[model samples]
Target: METYDKIGINYNKTRKVDQRIASIIEENLQPKGINLKLLDVGAGTGNYSNFFSSKGYNVTALEPSEIMLAQASHNNNIKWIKGSAEDIDIQDNFFDGVFSVLASHHFNNLQLAISEINRTLKSKHFAVIFNADPSLVSKKSWLFDYFEIVFEKAISKYINIESFKSLIQSTANTHVKIIDYPLPDNLTDNFFASGWKKPSLYLDQTFISGISPLASLETNTLNLIQERLENDLKNGTWNNKYGQILEENHFDDGYRFLIWQKP
Candidate 1:
């Protein structure tokens, strides 16, 4: 919860759900009715909730981080419940659809979340969840593969698509139809996790928000990490193994979005 209050400050930075990805999610994860009662787990900062609420659907935001819920309350539009997906106190079969983005990896009790998801939704209900590349625990990216060694040493393990299947499905038949929305870039282990440092124009607070997903690190800690990364970039240690990237923008990693339905 503490992390979110701090993390929520920069939550919208590099992480707006790409409309390209959102379009696919919207197409497949659509509710059955116009005024559908929807649930958004890990609704950080209310960006996505606000987006859906704009369209006239009732969106209930369930976020574990109290700080995030506070920030999300900036808009008085949605129902903000301070709870994780696993421990959601709402009633059974309470929603037509449920969705969350970039917050799946932070789940402490993933199985509980899955069980809760199943318990809360009636038959025919759907839940959509999206998270970043688990293997991409490093800082380097297609734009900045040079920093991989540095970042790889400093990151933690992330959740993958297969883990979603194991966590959510009790039976083989009641499964999540996984759709991995990979970034439209190199998939090899050579690319960086954070991507190149962005073009000169993109290096402002925008960079702070849109750059790193390092939500756990404080500002000072983040600075130390960046300081080392900059040192590596300058000393040419990064470029020796990974060459300077010609292009800086436009990347799409196979960051998966698992779409589950109950019959």
Candidate 2:
């Protein structure tokens, strides 16, 4: 069974597409035009795939998890395929553009996946939106203070931005551009760090369950973290330390858009 298959039951309830991020993706691929033949590698639940399809792009939504794919909204413009990133079952130079959002960390082999993306992209343009190395972003995160172990583990899982840029450039001979994406206060998507400003949302079991790192924690660990967080919020301890962040409208928590294009 795929990893998301086990944890994706309530995914759609919280992982809706934030149009602000969607528009950025659209703008990145818009140069290719609406007739672009696009592939969404790791199209978990097809939120972005459906978004692009609705805008008139012919999108192939490839995902390894049946549970995630099953939850995708039915759309005539999207051709859904059950597949993995490292071994895409598509013809060579087939797609005009390819994109993946918040899904690369779960890949079994990052190098092979990049090779496959290069192999199948006719335009040799690949755009991926993912978290940078957690070490760079977690220093200011409340998660680092509360869920120390889980946050540390996540730091090891995420790729360093510089290393990832070098990898993409070396592997595919593509020019890579990094775009910083700050988490908006009103972000609709409830990913791991989306609740940066609204810390209380982390106390919700359903919300945390939708995040892989937090969801994977043992019951006791989660209970302890929740208890500590609740105490901090009630006593104004959390606000004393991190309350200044609440005044900001958005935060740059190492979320970035990496666009790779072959010259």
Candidate 3:
């Protein structure tokens, strides 16, 4: 019945953990060795939460969707909690750090959520947020060329990086640092822009459905796009236009990480 329930079990199938992203989060947070407490707001299937917990940090995986949480892997080290970003149930100044990956757009009230995150973190610690900036994403992403509807919807929903920074600044008393986190050509995680270099992978039904924005699209629309893309690939039209990506190991795709620290 939940918004994300439709893709519950299938969520983890394509959405695996990418160490590159994990390492970036860890580096930004700069955890104080083992047993440090961390909070993962909007933790869909607890991918990052599980990874941090395995690294010896006590992690709280906070997710609003019950169906998605039901499918999350249980770990003794990670505590899975059902809650929304606007109102975290935990106590004040309880966590060493908090991070949200590609989930801020889901928050009904981003300022309130940032305030909640700011309130929950220990002073001088960090809260890291990662997402794609719509303005920048429109530049080089091929998804716009294929699935036009999905891209339009995503761009409308996602906040621009500058506006996001300003929102965090207004709501939280933290020093904000913006970091560019471009997707590697062979990224293990199957997020929206992950298939930038590997264009043909987007043709797979299972792969397309696993992506949140595209999954929300109508079946007919998806099928039409797939049909057109398949034809383009068969006739070499795709490579003729976007062949440069095949040689590159990474693409920017407007992915960014915002590190907020209370000082």
lDDT for each candidate structure = 0.61, 0.82, 0.84
Tens digit of per-residue lDDT, candidate 1, span 1-263: 65566656655544454455555656666667667777878777677787778767788888887656655644545888888876988888888887877666667777777777767776787778776654543334533243343344333556556765666666323777777554543222112233433322222444454333444446675666566556766787656645555343434444677788866
Tell me how many clashing residue pairs each candidate has: 13, 0, 0
lDDT tens digits by residue: candidate 3, 7-46: 6668888887898898899999977755799999999998
Tens digits of per-residue lDDT, candidate 2, 116-171, equal: 98899876455554545576675656757877787688778878888888888888
Q: What's model 3's lDDT at 140?
A: 46
Ordered from best to worst lDDT, the candidate numbers read: 3, 2, 1
Which sections of candidate 3 miss by over 4 Å? 138-141
TM-scores of all models? 0.75, 0.95, 0.96
- Where is model 2 more than 4 Å wrong at Cα? 124-126
Q: Any runs in candidate 1 off by more than 4 Å, and if so which?
A: 12-17, 73-77, 136-156, 171-173, 184-215, 218-225, 231-254
* Predicted structure with the largest TM-score when compared to the true one: 3
Which candidate model has the greater TM-score, 2 or 3? 3
Displacement of residue 84 (Cα, Å) in model 2 is 0.5
Q: How close is each model in CA RMSD to the real structure?
A: 5.0, 1.6, 1.4
